[model samples]
Each structure stands twice: as structure tokens, then as C-alpha cells.
Target chain A: MTENNEYAVECEGLGRVYRSRSLLGQSRETVALQDLNLQIPKGTVFGVLGPNGAGKTTTIRILSTLLSATTGTARVLGYDVVKEGREVRKNIGIILGGDRGFYGRLTGKENLRYFAALNHIKPRDTDRIIDDSLAQAGLADQQKTLVEQYSRGMKQRLHVARGLLTDPGVVFMDEPTLGLDPLGAQELRQRIPALVGQGKTVLLTTHYMFEADSLCSRIAIINKGKLVALGTPAEIKRNFSSIGVIELTLNQTRPSLQEELTGLDGVKRATTSADGVYQKLTVHVVAGADLSDKIAEVVGKDHIENMVARDPTLEEAYLEIID
Target chain B: MRNFFVQAYLSYRGLFLWLNWTAYISNVVLRPILMLLMFALVGKFAADSDAAQAYMIGMIGYAIPVILLGGILQSFVYERVFGTISFIYSSPGSRVAVFFSRGVLHFPNSILACALSFLFGWLVLSLDLSTLNWWTMIVSVLLTAAACTAFALFLGNFTMMLGEFFNLYNAAMGLFLAMTGVIIPIASLPWFFGDLANGIPLTHGLVALRGAFAGMDIGAVRDELLLEALVGLGYAIAGIVVYMLVERDARARSSLERSPA
Candidate 1:
């Protein structure tokens, strides 16, 4: 693939295969990613959503030049990730958010200073740049505290600050909000648009459907190392907009209830999950299907406590695509 | 150039947790001194004052490799364990600067350990200082510590690749103690073992150190000192080559964050 100005990140037929040999001389190969093609436009938040082990991190690692692709090519800001790795690295920042990346004994500011040096930031500019990044991540007040003493949310924010130390044009964030409270996640989610405002293209991988829906201008859903769905959140949901959902909270349920509902005329898929003393049954149907009366008859109205009908959510749409 | 020193200082302070006053005094200072006294006393009980002095100088030579090797290896090990090695590899920083900086603080630390060991030998073991050539002794100590630090940097790549710090540390310590004439004269060993000893760092440096303590001039042990310097340079070059190769392999195999199981 050749470099393109319009796209901040590009990949063509990208694939990665991991091979391992056992002590007993047995070998196994795992295809973490394969034939993955993506062209993320400049100055946009491109979200990649995938289930666990779906190669989201593999993609990030390759684009960040941390791992080379086994086959095909990837470029960050027109630099080939493999052949021109140094140039690629110079123009991109990576944040693999987790509790493990920081030196616990070092203060947050000291850690940033070390990484700043690693990024080749000049000594004269290091403090100013670090201060700006810390303030941007809302970590200025706690910059002097040891990282081990910081809460998990604070560590995550520090990861973001570190990634922006060089002010790279493209940033790759792998699960930046994986383990945070609702408030902490919300605070981080709010920081995404500001990055775009600064004209930085962000490629974010997340498991949160709503976060993707709200923040990403375009989202790609990958499964089994392949791009299964790609579109704006609304467009993705629009594809499944013709499907309606009917939910029933019942006092009890039998194993046959799902099979019985799946056999209904307009029912596309049926699933049941237990919540405390109640069994919640969700049925997907074609638009305008009024199967509630028939479902009540099948389930027996005495066993049903409540019923509601609604349009499919982004999460529901994502589940349908993945399934 | 400034970035190199900044990285070296920050990494040394950040990764080497034992730099705290308590751990430093206990692990770095007291531990080595106590070991030196114990071994020198053993020699005294076994033979006489001359034997004890030999053992004391030998133990002093051994102290540099132990401190320097462990310090350098621990830096690499902590980088891996803390998962920061991936960030370092992923950056656009100069690999030369990053690689060599790991030894910057460690070299001086090794020198300090050597000085402490000598002080303890004089104060506790009653090692004679009158016959010591201060100038040559300083040169020997500096060269010996540099050689040991370079050797540690060479082995540090293995610590990063294998993720078995203690295993490599113990094996290296064992090899140096037995083969580098730390306690035994290399000449007395088998011819094959002597040949092996020629390749290990500090073997010649220790000889030059003993020569310096015997009041020999730099000209007298010049060959050994030169050989020591050459050995250190060889290991340093070998270390850089190994690091580049391992880095390439890690990028290919996606194993930079941790060693593959």
C-alpha cells in the first residue's frame, strides 16, 4: 500500500500469525488478525469495537510499530509501519492503558519526564510539554504523587497524558477505559473530542457500545480477525433498525421458552437471562410484528409481570452483527 | 546527548527501587562488606595473615561484578516486569543512547562498592595499605568496574529475552566467582578452564588489581589492564549487537512486553 494524505492510518490485507512450539515438540499457530483492511481519515475518531481476542490490540500494536505484521502493510501518516518504522514511530503515539505500564515508585510527573526523554523531547521543552499534557489530562494536581499511590482512574489518565507528550498527529488507544468507574469512564470519554479538536486522529478500541456510539464518527466491528461491520454508529444501527424488540419480565421461565419464541412467525432471535427472582426474555422481531399477545398466550399471562416494546439499540445491533 | 543523561538518570532512579536509604545501606553496602569480612576471616582461619590479605583483595575484586551485574540486570528486569520495555522499544529514541545509558549510573555504583569493600578490608581485616600503589589501584578499580559493567550489559539482553533474572544472575555470579580468580588463582586451574577464564570479564582485571596492590607500576600490569579494557569493549559491542537482534526478533514475534512462554 502507498501513503495517502487524506488518511491518517491505512492498512491493506494486514495479517498477523503467532506460532508457538511446546516443550513436547508440538506446534500451534494462532491467526490473531488476517486480511484486515482499514483507512481511517485524518482528524476523526475511528473506533474499533470487538469482542475479547478479536485482534483489536493486534491492530493497535502493528500501527504503533510495536509488532510487525506477518503479511501485508500498514502505514501511519503515510509512513509504512514496517519498512519506515522509525518515521512511523516519530509521528504516532500509543497508549496501552492498564495498571502495569508505569514505574510505581516514580511520581507521575517523573514518569512523564522519562518518557519525554524517550520521545526525544528537548530538555528545554520537556517540562512545559509535560505540564501541558498533565493539565490536559486533569492530572496536574497529582503530578507529584507516586504512581503507586494514585487510584486506577488517575493511572489511566496519566497514560493518556504520556501518549500526548509528543503531540503526534495520530494516537492509538487500546482499551483506555477498560477498568474505571462510571464517573471515571465518563470523564475520560469527555476528553476524546478535545483530542479531535486539536486535529489529532484517534483510533480507539473499546468494548463499550454506548461510548463508541457517542464518541466515534465511524466505527468498525471486527470478529474472528475480520471486519464484520463498518459504518457510522447511526448507519450501523440503521441496518438493524427494521428489527424491533419485545421484552417480558416473567416470574419464572422454562428452558423451552426460547425455542418456543424462536418458532414464532416474525421472531428473528430470542434470548433469556435471569435477573434475581425474575427471568427477562428478549425477542427480536420484524418491524410492526405484534407478537406480544401470542407470546403472552405461549408464556401464559399469569406468569408475565410486565412487557415493553422498543427499537433496537446500538448494543443490540452490534450483538446481531457479531452473532 | 542531554537526553541520554536524562534517560540514564531517570531510569536508574525509577527502576532501581533499592536506591532508598534503607535498602541501599542493607543490600548494597552492609551485605557486601559483611560477606567480605566473613570470607577474609575464613582465609585467616585456614592459613595466615598473607592468605587473609589475598582473600580480602579477591573479595574486593568480586564485589564489583556482583554489584554492577546485579544493578544492570535489575534495570532490564524491572523494565520488563513493569511493562515499560514495550514503550521504550516503540519510541523513536536512539537505541545506542538507551542501551548504553543503563550502565551509566551502575558503573559508579560498582566503584562505590569497591571502595567500601577496600575500606572494610583495611578497618576490619587489617589489610596492609602501605604497599598499595594508590594511582595504579585506582586505575585497576576503575577498569575492573567498567569491565564488569560492560559484561553485565552483555548479559542484560538475556535477562530481557529470557525473563529469568535470578537464574541468570546466580549462574553468572557462580561462573565469575569460580573462574575469574576471585578466590582461586587462574594459573592453578586446568588448562581448559584457564582458556575459558580468558574470555570472562574481570579475570585479567583481578590479576592487574592484585598486581597494583602488590605495589606494581602501571607498566608492569599494562598488558592485563589493556586486555581488560579490550574485553570490556568486546562485550559492549556484543551487547549492542545482541540487543538489536533481539529487538528485531521481538518486533517480528510480538514478544517485547514479556518473554514468550
Candidate 2:
């Protein structure tokens, strides 16, 4: 179920700003987010993909109801995050700004118990929740060990367990794998989607593109407090997709071809590679024009070989979209 | 309300004391033995056990305020500055379950730590706590904790670091030394100085706290006892109100962004 209609989270112009003194001791207003609109469909893992400081944390903060929107309105699970905050908190589970919600001295079992009590689980039910949570967190064996002793990866796992403590309809994980070892990072990437498999909606934010590609059902990329792109990974890639690349391997230094290739009617752009034995040239032609024929006839078999035409990658499209 | 403090107390109870004590609290357990050696060497200490016993009782009275300030209230500061406060804040239950909710748990922590430290001091100094009125002493210890927790919580509002806790601790202790009759009795001081001490919460608190050390009837010190409890509770509530306002600004969130408050 798409969270848009089932609507786990919806935002209309959410924003956050911080006022800080600059290096020169000048007061400056840094707008972390501004006029940003967003929607996360229920049961889907919606990702907020952005470079660091793209307001991902700020956005997650608002939707999780840990934050109140300065200007716009946001709702989580049909509850207005600002006005009906208690209900919003009831519907969504959040692990925002990474590992901010844990006590170091409490053992894994104790930590879960404390959080469960605060979440209002009845005394008898709390024991079951703690048992289930320690197991779910994969900290079952180490449940008796204090949180301070747990490695960074283990703390993150506990954070996920705590997020699921309420069994809410929607969940939020910010930088889900921010400071994990490769194995741990990969482990978290898999663990996140399992919540969705059980029909829980997830809203996640990450700086890793691969994480988004591997996990998100749809993504919204915010740049400088604005929504730069919003769509499915495939759909977004297609929006900026490009084709027609001519790759070449050459032996000689041809500085003169720079002008000839640049001025050519079929060639769009040309640049020499570091090896001096390779050149990559791309051409965007007027639809009716034939550039392949021009390359074969004009460039003359001497310098060009390993020539290939291919569609651009999502990586390239993402760069082009942002640039 | 009961559950809130239960969570807060249980959440923080042993961890903080263990944290401070494991480092030096217990390591100094032998200090009283060392002091006994000195007392044996000094003629003024007396061969009579009462002199050595008085030293222990006095030590307990002195350590009460120090442990109260450092052990609990400081830990609360760490809990917040380190971000564990957010964990508690996210929960649905009352933040005001007093001690359990951690809304004003600091005052209680300080008070309880004071009692614990005094007990430690008693054993170390070879004091005669054996004849002490257990019930009255317990009440005094709790009152001392409540008062100090309020003080620490009040000071915590001004800074974000545990170092700030020390700053507040030192300032309060200096003021405390003259008031609690920990050093000299406030009654011995000149009238102006005595009046300042009389009005302070610690003054009223120590009146009860010191009475417990004397093995006296604590509840009978009625008016001063009630006044101190009211003052501690008042400070706690007022401190919480200030914290709520200041912390709201600190949280800022998007609400602050749109409103710029």
C-alpha cells in the first residue's frame, strides 16, 4: 500500500532553521529546511535521499513529532504532527539523529524495559515486550550486558528494536547505517525492510545512494531546503537519463583533434583521458541527424576503436539532476 | 505518578552511584582506618570511644551534602547533555511523575546520594551509627536529597556540560558549609549572617538533617521541617517550569523555525 493514500506521513512546506554565531562571531541564520513538501505511503519504505545537511534529519524530526514545523503542516498516520502530537507519536516509531534515545548504563533488557514502561505497556506485558525486543534486536544473548559495552553496531540494532517497541503503523530511521562496519551496515539495510514486510510503513533518510536504491520504494531528495526530486528510483533516473556515448582507445596525443572534434556537427563534447591512450566523446544530435555515420566516415578508423554507444547510468543521471 | 518515578528511579538508581563510587567512593572505604590511626596518635582524639565516635558522626554530617550534589544531580546533567533525556522525552507517559518521570528526579537523587554518602562516611570514620534513630535519619536524608536535587536542577539550567555541575556544586557547597552547621553552627555566626542562613532551604533542611545525626526526634522539629519540604518542592516545580521553557527553546525544532522564537 502506497503511504500516499494510506498516508503514513504527509508534509506541506515543513521547515527548520538554526541561528548560530559564525567563525567571525557574526550571527547567522542557517535554514536547515524550508518550504519542503513530502509524502510517505503506508507499508512502503519511503526514503529521504540527500547529501549530508540536506535537511534529512530536520525532516525526519518533524515527521516523527520530535519536532514541530515552523511554517508548514505535517501529519503522521492521519494525526496532525503539530496539534495532535500524542496521537502522531502513537502511530509512528522513530530513531532520529541516530542513537539519541538510549541510556548507556542500562542493559539491553533494562533499556527496553525502561522505554516500554515510558511507552505505557502494562507491567505484565512489559516482560513479554522486553523479551521479544531483545530477541528482535539480536541482543538476546547479550541482553544482560550494559549498553555502554555494546559496539556501535549493537547500539544501532537496539535502536531499531526500540523503534519497533510500540508496534506503530509507521517507523522512521535516520541515517540507518551511518557509522557501521560494512557487514553491520549491510545487516541494517536488510533489517529495515523486514518491518515493511509485516505491513508497517517506514520513512527513512540516508546519505548513501546504494542504500536508497536497494531499500526505498520511492525517494524524495531535498537540496538546500527545497525538494529537488521526488519519484521512484527508476522513474527519477529516467527523468535525467541520457544515451549515445562513443568510447575510444587511441595511441597518439592528438591535441589538434580537440578543435576538430569540438567543431564537428555530429559531436557534442570531447575530453581526453588521463592514460593519453583513451578519449571519451559524447554527442547529442538534432533528432534527424545521424552521428554514428559521421564518426565512422570523418574520424577514419586510425584513432577510434573500442567504440560503443550506451545509455547513461543512474549515477550519471543523479549527478546531472543535481548539477 | 507512581509509575513515572518508579521508571525514573529504577532507570537511574544504581547506575550513577556505581559510576561515581566504583571510581573513588568505595576506594576511600579504608580512609576511616587511616583516620583512626591518627586519632590514636593525637591526644585530643581521646582514648574514650566517644571522641572517635564523634569524629565519625561529624564526618557523616559533612559528607551528606557533598554526595547529594555530586552523585545524583550531576548524573541527571549527564543524562540530558548526553541525549538520554530524549529517550525519556519521546515516551507517552507523564514527565512529571516526579522522581520516576525524571521531571524533578534530580532533587531526590541528590538527597538520596547524600544519605548513602553519609552512611559510607559513618562506616569509614568508625562512627557509632548503631544507636541512631533509623526512622528519623531516613527522613532527614530524604529531605536533604530533595533540597539538593532542586538546587542542582536549578543550576543545571544555566549550562550544558557536567563541568557546569561542578561549578554549581562548588558554589553551593561553599554556601552550604556556613549554613548547614556542617563547620560551625549558624547560631554562632553574627545576626546578619545567621538571618541569611535561616532563610535558606539548606538551613532548614540541615536543622532536620543534623538532628538525625544527634539521634533526636526529627518530626518534632515541625515548622522548620514543613518549611524546608515546601521550599524543596517549590524549587523543584519552579525549576521544572524554567527547564520546560528553556528546553523548549533548546529543542527549537521546526516549530522554532516557522516561529523563530
Best by TM-score: 1
For model 1, the superposed segments whose C-alpha errors exceed 4 Å read: A240-260, A270-282, A286-311, B259-261
lDDT of 1 by residue, A46-134 (tens): 99988999999999999998888999898899989888999988988888888878889889999999999988998999999999999
lDDT tens per residue, model 2, A175-219 = 867767788688777877788888898888887777887788998
Q: Which 10 residues in a row give candidate 2 chain B its minimum summed lDDT?
A: B252-261
| Displacement of the residue A184 alpha carbon in candidate 2, Å | 3.8
What docking grade applies to model 1? medium
Q: Which numbered prediction scores highest in lDDT against the true structure?
A: 1
Question: How good is the docking of model 2, as DockQ?
Answer: 0.39
Give the 10-residue window scoring lowest on summed lDDT in candidate 1 chain B: B252-261
Backbone clashes in model 1, listed as residue pairs: none
- TM-score for every candidate vs. truth? 0.92, 0.77
**What residue runs in model 2 are displaced by over 4 Å at the alpha carbon?**
A1-5, A22-25, A97-101, A240-311, B1-6, B13-21, B24-59, B98-138, B153-164, B187-199, B209-220, B253-261
Q: List the TM-score for candidate 1's chain B.
A: 0.96
Q: What digit string (tens of lDDT, one per residue) describes model 1 on residues B1-261?
A: 888898899899887867889988876798779879988988889988888888889889888988888888988878888889888888999888889999999888888888999998998779988888888889998998888888999999998888757889999999988999988889988769998898898899899989988999899999999999999999999999998988999899877676334
